[model samples]
Target: MIEHIIEIAFYLSTALTLFILMLPSQYGPTPRGSSDSAAEPKTTVQVLVLGDIGRSPRMQYHALSIARGGGQVDIIGYHESDVHPDISSHPRIQVVALPPHPFCLQTSNRVIFLLLGPVKVLFQVFSLWWILAYRTKPVKWLLVQNPPSIPTLAIASLVCFFRQTKLVIDWHNFGYTILALKLGDNHPLVKISRWYEKAFCKSATAHLCVTNVMASVLKKDFKLESPILPLHDRPANHFQPIQDDQERKEFLLSLSETAPVRGLLKEGKAEVIVSSTSWSPDEDFSLLIDALCRYSEISNTSKPRLPHILAIITGKGPQREMYVERISSLQNNGKLRNVTIRTAWLSTVNYARLLASASLGVSLHTSSSGVDLPMKVVDMFGSGLPVVGWSRFKAWPELVTDGVNGRGFGSSGELVEELIDLFGNPAKLEKLRIGARESSSYRWDDEWTPVAGKLLGLV
Candidate 1:
């Protein structure tokens, strides 16, 4: 047994040596003020923001908040098609794009990901280490987004330790839960990932959660003692509703010719319902689809005076084609006449424009993390578009108050009834819209600036 233990230790030491050799050489001694002792007051705080998922807006928001708070931020993230302009154009912000991963990995193929995921992750970690440790200026803090479903915190923690920077993980969703959704909860990899997640989260210097419920979960489930700030998404300054009717008309006409809005356009007046979905199974968009279909049936058969419906569904995902086909089938069968459904994968500007012009918004997201609030709902409220959201999430009450700013529903039947009642009464719809606008008076900058300042010790 002694000989076996020695052999194992020898192999582990060898692997450690090989890993050290593989890392890029550090450039000279650490600069002054780069050490932990250098946490003194500085004119400009430098922050390194890392995000594995490129499409996430939370990272962008955080970066903007940091920049607006007088920090120079360097964002290292995966390449994405629709990068937000505010992040790209900020004077103090630098955006670094990672080389695209292989198509197989991008598609989330379980077999190929299992085969090549480790190698790919190692490459990414090395690239990040080289950037954070050697390439960029000394950073005071490293803010990372979780739920790339990988153990990124482990890598960030090591980087922070060596660079003498604080590591702040903005927990969006737990990787283990996402893994369990993709694989089974009993899978060996899932179990291993859960262990790693707990370990790394416990090691972080600070945590920022999307909702208060998530912070509670971190404390109870992971036993994480790190100071956690619940920084929910808020509307940017640009998300105001379009008060001009001509601008709304022009915006409606700028939509794709294939969009379902043409029916509404011809009617001179229309009821525009907007909903955003990630197209994942967790969202249960079928509920909204069923509600829309039922609303159409009721409008045509029961109430003839209801305005024509133009339902705009925004976002693209793996399940997009399936849902698109489902909606198309309903339209072809003439079951959806009073309502025309359109699926649009829009840029940030166009999406905001669509939201600003919308009469009502629907959010089907059921929060795969159960604790994190649906950001789509936040964006809807930001646009002053009243929302009909799922009632199940722990954070629902904090964002949506039934019969107030927005309403929540537990079932498709309830949602359909609510939709019918709201659309049938213009006074109620207008009241909800006013409530949405009033509720969204709080700004992202207002909520995040102080929290970010506190996290960075800038306040």
Candidate 2:
């Protein structure tokens, strides 16, 4: 019944929008068919990211690419964090914050979650419609992020239908699979979520999936008529490897002054390992902690002493403080040694530098859909840093070439073995680093411009 009501609203919003467009120039905003003579020469493309704009790096990259191709873009999303200046400051790109989702979204209690879900969906529908109908100007091409499939996909499809716009969906993962994580896979909600994803996905004029595996599933199963482009995340120009040893030296000296990692720095003596996390449910930080504990044992009580490790975990999420407490307990109890674990929330500039300067990288992502690749690993590769990634998924092999660019581990014991083997054997570590460095050549524009850029009308 609620889904029916939302479907009705989609049509109603279209009718109301059409009415607004028919009004006189003085009475209402400019119509979809007409354009401002003084505005940007190229048609404005709208990128709708229902999630946090700052955190949605791939969508932001898409907007940036469009801008680079002499296109103006209206990036509509929640400005929850500081955006990279490249997009926010670009003359051709405009970031528009959506009407905020008005509900307690952080509640983990299933009962409270179930109770609040309907009201939240209702609010999202109205808020999204209000923005599309009255706030943003009409666009020719509208690109939206999936896994936020429910309201976003439905609403985007409706707006595009009425406005004569082409809908493009950038698939990161399946919304149904993610919902199944919270509500069991057998749950009715999970089943409905899957149905909704398939139904709305057909409305897309073009699809950009994170992996070829995802594209195959969408075509074979969903039977989408649109052009499916397997668009993997590649690092932007800013994420460059540190070529100058002196620059890395200065970067470490600067990071050592920061409170979180203060007194934790051993400079040249310590091997700096960087890991990024959202601290979300899919990521099991316990695996990382367990591996570190075993690594400490190998370093202290074993032969061929390993260098001290300074582990820097970056990014913010709900589970952050819990892991911080666990890390503190390990350190204070003397159970974790030769390893100093520190967490940070860094700016884009600092993060790129961190990736470039760090000796190695770690990934804890277990894709909810088991096919989506982790973008963090791509960033590490861009900076010529070899990664030790979670290999519990299909797409990891496509991104991390086991023995080439990086190594993948399925268990904590394996991870400990990997850490000890690589860190203890500098020659092996350097070889992997060399292989990862080759990936630095694969820039975003190099791949994007040839396919997605041309598809989006980029010359």
Candidate 3:
């Protein structure tokens, strides 16, 4: 019995040795951060842009472009369906994949993600801390894209505290108010989240806000001394004009089948394109649709029929089903005379093309909906499309100088009135289009170059 056991053990040991020898030397997940001394010489400016890459393509493009343009820029972003390929290709731009939490979003593949959530969070936290500990001596600046969340901001603050690196908070939305409005103010989760937000904002050395309104709120409420730099997220310049005239004609012809184009060019039928992600109370797209339907009822038919409105409502959320139902009901009842609703995942390039063809763009939300100047607004500028919608938030008024580039409406009644006025007059639309192009030009460059330069003392 002893001799047989000895023989078995010897064979097992020999097999294990063979397996190890045959196995590949390098076998594991992709390496994180810089591995070689080559990335050592240049200034390392690590920028973390977490959550919703698709929502801010133009902003992401500019941020990544600027980072790579100067020195070593390491970018860690959340996993979106379509990722920016440039980041993957760039030598300096490191793309860290962040898996979504199952607890936060619903999915059939729940168990796997639920286990992964805690693991990912721990790994990310550890990786960030490791960067702080090891890379600080060489690192120059640390920029957090929207340092308003606890896990994200905590990492930024902790790194800044010990590493002695300059901390930049990219304030996309009012941390507390956005969560309170999005997930309900009474929510226990939001209450805890706000505490982290306040701490991070206070500790930040500098900030980048979407508009002057956000800066004011941060100054007044947070009592933060950090320079709240006003930067505009420029529109993504991906849309190339249709080279083939025949192809363009066919595409327009297909569109005419659904809704007849009555003198779209001759009489100048102004097309209003509204592409909003959220149909929630914050977005208030329902109000715009309601106001349009109301205006269509009262407006005179003899007058050049108010530019055939074509509003494309995209995205999926809690309010998605209800919004689709509402629009469908309007069409069924013949209440929606000219409005058209198209729902789907819009590629950045395709979305830009749609905006290019559109005569006007609109973004509407309530007063409470602050800090969320939808990235679509930037796309509107990139496409050189004028805007017309409710401008209650502080950013709206500043970004879109009402009556200059876009018309601002306070109430639902005002939104309706403005739409009517713009549709009735074609020349006003032309002037606004010119203004939009001019107004948005500054915003495009502001995203990365000037902001990064300011942070690095290069500006």
Give the candidate number with the greatest lDDT.
2
All candidates' lDDT scores?
0.76, 0.84, 0.63
> What clash pairs does model 1 have?
none
Q: Which is the winner by lDDT between candidate 1 and candidate 2?
A: 2
Cα distance off (Å), candidate 1, residue 147: 1.4
lDDT (Cα, tens digit) per residue for candidate 1, span 145-261: 887636467777776765666778888888887777777789998899988899877767888888888889888988988788888778877677776867876787788832556
265-312, model 3: which lDDT tens digit per residue?
A: 334453646565655556776777688687667653636666666666
* Candidate 2 local distance difference test against the native: 0.84
Worst 10 residues of 1 by lDDT: 39-48
Where model 3 places Cα greater than 4 Å from the true spot, the runs are: 1-41, 103-139, 159-165, 182-192, 239-272, 299-302, 367-372, 446-448, 457-459
Distance from true position, residue 330, model 3, in Å? 2.1
The TM-score, computed over Cα atoms with residue i paired to residue i, of candidate 3 is 0.75
RMSD of candidate 3 to true structure, Å? 10.3
Backbone clashes in model 3, listed as residue pairs:
none
What candidate 1 gets wrong by more than 4 Å, as runs, is 22-54, 108-138, 257-260, 266-269
RMSD of each: 3.5, 4.2, 10.3
Clashes of each: 0, 0, 0
lDDT, candidate 2, 105-144, per-residue tens: 5476789899888888888887777777567777778899
* Candidate 2 clashes between residue pairs 3 or more apart in a chain or in different chains: none
